[model samples]
Target: MISLSKSIRWLFCLLLTLAAAFPAPAISAAAAEPLALGSSEFYYLAGHMEVLKDPSRSMDFKKALEAYGRGEFLPLPGTLNAGYGRNAYWIHFTLKRGVAFPEKSMLSLSPSYTNSVKVYVQRQGRSPLLPSSFSPVLLGSDVPVAERPVLNPNFVIPLDLQADEPVEVFVRVYSKGSISLTGQVATYGSLRNSTYYSIMIQFGYLGIAAVLCVMNLIFFFAIRDRLLLYLVLYVFTVLVNNLAVSGMSTLLFPNHAHLISDYMVYMGIGAQVLVFSEFSYHLFHDFAGLWLLRYIRFMSVVGVLTIISVSLGFYASVVPFALIGIIILITMLLLTSKKLLVSMPQSGIFITVAFGISMLGYFFQIFRLIGIIPLEPGWEINMVEPATLVHMVLISIALSERFRITERQLADASRLSEKRAVEIAEDMTGELRENKERLEVALAAEHLSAERQNQFLTMLSHEYRTPLAIIQGNLDILAINSENGGEEESQELQKMRRAVARLVDVMDVSLMQNRMLDLQVVGTSTIICADEFIRQQVDAVRWMWPERSFTLHSELVEESVFGEAPLLNTALFNILDNAQKYSPCDTAIEIRTWADGDFVMISVSNGIAGISIGDSESLFDKYRRGACSHDTSGAGVGLWLVRKIIEEHGGTVKMNSAAHGRISVGLAIPVERGETPYCQKK
Candidate 1:
């Protein structure tokens, strides 16, 4: 049997060889013309390495190379900074000054290392290097790189270094290539024939890591669910897997290697357990389906046991950590089983099944690692891509729920706020503005009454004298006739009677108009339906104006219209009487009624000889009659009173004059289409 050191070395060499055989970029051929010994100055590649050389151009590099005398290590420029893979060593060199290196590959390992190890070389502090960046031109003879590599002792990597100019080198050894610790290869942890397999696994891990990162971000936006806490853990798990599989964890974070290797396996397993705990908590509600929690507790206990196993020595330490993770994926399945029990709805059942399968995949992964489950290309490594993907999916589901709920809440809040704002505006305008306007109107009305009183007294001084004079004349006649007693006395008495009657009628009309205009309503806490009350006025007017021709009409009123019937009556009579006096004799006066959903419309038409139609608008003003109203016998306050009545009833009046010289008055009042109008308050 071989010695221990020799066997271990063989195992290492075998692993490196297999790793080098893994899939990676093929090495490129040297340029058509070799670089000469003395050529260019310096070349660079960003943040990695840079080199300068002299007499660096050559065809056969073996002759021109001023290689180090054997038995000495080559020094290369390097850094210990965190960004440059902290605490790592590299080989940096320069040809004699004034030379440039071209088309040089500092180190090239067997393709197997594409998975188990990675080699990146570039001129430091410059942009990225491409294949065709520079080429060598020969100015010197051959070199000694053709000898079989001596570092091929299984564990040692045989590095091929060549360049037209002196170049720097960096080498990395992957700790994840867990080949057999013996010289001979085996099935489960083989040292040969699986080099390419390891590299592909690493590449797969990177792809998975990228996917996990993308999915986590998406979920974060969508669900914002507390479950994302578990997703974060899963993302870490993915990162750890990538580093371990790529061997980067060992090269860049050597302090974390062993821990990271085991962490990949354990965290991948532990994430499932945590996920199950969270799922069970969310799915079955309370602690109702708590057997899984107990299982998790048991697994955690085992994990601690596994950690202690480490102190027992490397041989016995692999069990607990691995076992805890694989104990039961069915816990997730069971968590879902309860959901599938029909009491649960199927809204998210697809997600449940998918996650359940993911849990199984985790179990399969862990089982495969410890030699329990068998699958093609078997063996768990520093990578957990599938597990990462599953975790990502779960995270996505949670985020979707969060986003959907948030969107709905925002929409609802927006609608409610908008509605409230509208209501507030209506209240301000309808209540406050209306009340302020009413107060201003009240003050205005008081001022108007004072002005009207002054005008009334002034007009009375002029008008009363004529009637009093006529009365005085009539009284004188009566006195004379009574004294004469016997001649033409009857005829004279009859004529006097006629004059007195005309005077009395005018006074009565004026008094009634005054009561309607200046009457003070103690309160309006009353309900007087226009339909009922208007009929009373219609009948009274038809009787009083027996000689006046007018056709009165009323239409269907779905609801009660509010108004003070008595005041309306006086107002209507004045309008009618005025119409009678000015209208051509024997012309029919028409009264018509109609109501829209919100307003009651009443139009009174008369064939009266009046002012021109152009002056109709002025008729509604107090003491302002249309020019067509000339020669009418009455105060112009008649139509003005119509406007006042309509205003008090929360309505408007419009006058329409026909081309034929007839005039019509139309009134519109705000009346409810249904329900009784609010009784007016006194």
Candidate 2:
């Protein structure tokens, strides 16, 4: 049994040796010598190179080189791209330097999405070393940037060669993303120009995408349209994905480049799919079936979840989600287009064209990444290059076309409305003209009536005053006669005379106010001391109503005022009279005068219980009276006259009532142009 077991083990060992001795062919080899590096500065590498597949991914540099010496390598089919594969690829090439070529050359591997890249060179004196052994020169995403032969966003390898010396080069590449080993060997100047244009194209795409994003965002807000909003999101995701896939994000997030580069593909794909789904939903919403919409929403949610999963390092799940999402999206678009073709034919046609253009570009890029299509060396094209710009332009065109249609509809409606308005105006024109003629006749009659009324009032005022003067004469005679009779008779006579005097005063003041309103009696103003003028008015009130007790208080800082003294005196007297008439006979009426900034204020307060006043503004209206004035025997025009006179002096009047049923009337008058007085406030 032991001998049999040993024979079996020896057979297994021999089989392994045979497998190692004859590796499977990957591609065919080129018969010509490798392209020489020269002053031309650039050489397409794939067509002139051979490639080997390291299925174990454990094949060290030394073994790979040994395999190369045995002619085991296969020529690169066209370009090296093995999309999302576990196996690492080794590309083999030889370079002979011309006398015109520089001593050093740069090799730039394209498409920065690869996770790891390593280059091995066999120069005139050195032997190839294993990758496990430390190499003074190494370059890849896994290698620290400081350890790289040349620092670059892409994997850059530096070569030192002598004139006419043949040098062997090998590059190993592997990635979770699509493995693309496309590169160029050139002089610094050629490489620099190539890099400049490549960078320009990359940044140009990003710049235009950024601009579209902003524009679409603005369109969303300006037009209040959700389609533009989705467009903005789509543009943003595409920009981020392009930045990640194109390897330009390393420029922005250098320290965190590995993190960005590793996960951004999944993130970008998930986000792009989700945003595109949303955009399509909004774009074709009119024709979207319920199930189709539900499917879209489901896929969108899944895409979002996939993005979360990817961020958490479940990158392997992205492919399934993406595939499912693509299927669902295509079905949705087709169903929507079919339904829209029958319902809204023009819009459906527009959508179909735009979608076709966009999908063409999308598929072109996807196929290129997956190695389904060969990439021509030195000829670079981004999937978004033709796709995104055309998509945006077409969508914008559709939107503009819709806007134009809407405008035409609105214009037709407006024209119809204008025509109807013209007809209505024509129908109403005669009625309006007739109304204007009638208004003119009515105004003329009103003017004549007002004139007659004014003349009658003037005549009445003269006649009334004549009779009141005669009645006052008769009352005086009767009082004299009653003085000799009895106390009751004299008191009756005094009451009769007081009533007559009050009626005459009311009539005179009313007529005077009428004259003031009619512009017949304009009172001229003169600078007068407000404190002295108010005191004189208070003294007159005391002399007239001796039985009614009153107190006058003055706080004069700037007492001079520009107003008619007689009018101001009359205003003050009317307020005092009203205060006395409304208050109980025993209650004293308090009149106070003070100076506020730039004005003199006269306040008359009385403890008139049950006097309920509402809005102070309405109280100043002509003929308006306080609620408590029902039993009072005076015309309600007293406060109104006071307000009118004060307002004429460019001042204001306000009325307020306190908690104790104390009503106060405050009158403000502008101070005259003069020096302020020394005040002894009381």
**Reference-based lDDT, each prediction:** 0.47, 0.71
Candidate with best TM-score? 2
Clashes of each: 66, 4
What would the per-residue lDDT of candidate 2 be over residues 528-618, giving only the tens digit for each residue? 8777777766776776788988898887744688766656766787888888887888888888887788888888888865355665568
Mind giving the per-residue lDDT tens digits that candidate 1 earns over 490-528? 655655554454444344334443544664444242455
**Which structure among the candidates has the greatest lDDT?**
2
Tell me the TM-score of each prediction against the true structure: 0.32, 0.60
Instruction: Report per-prediction Cα RMSD to one decimal.
Output: 24.5, 12.5
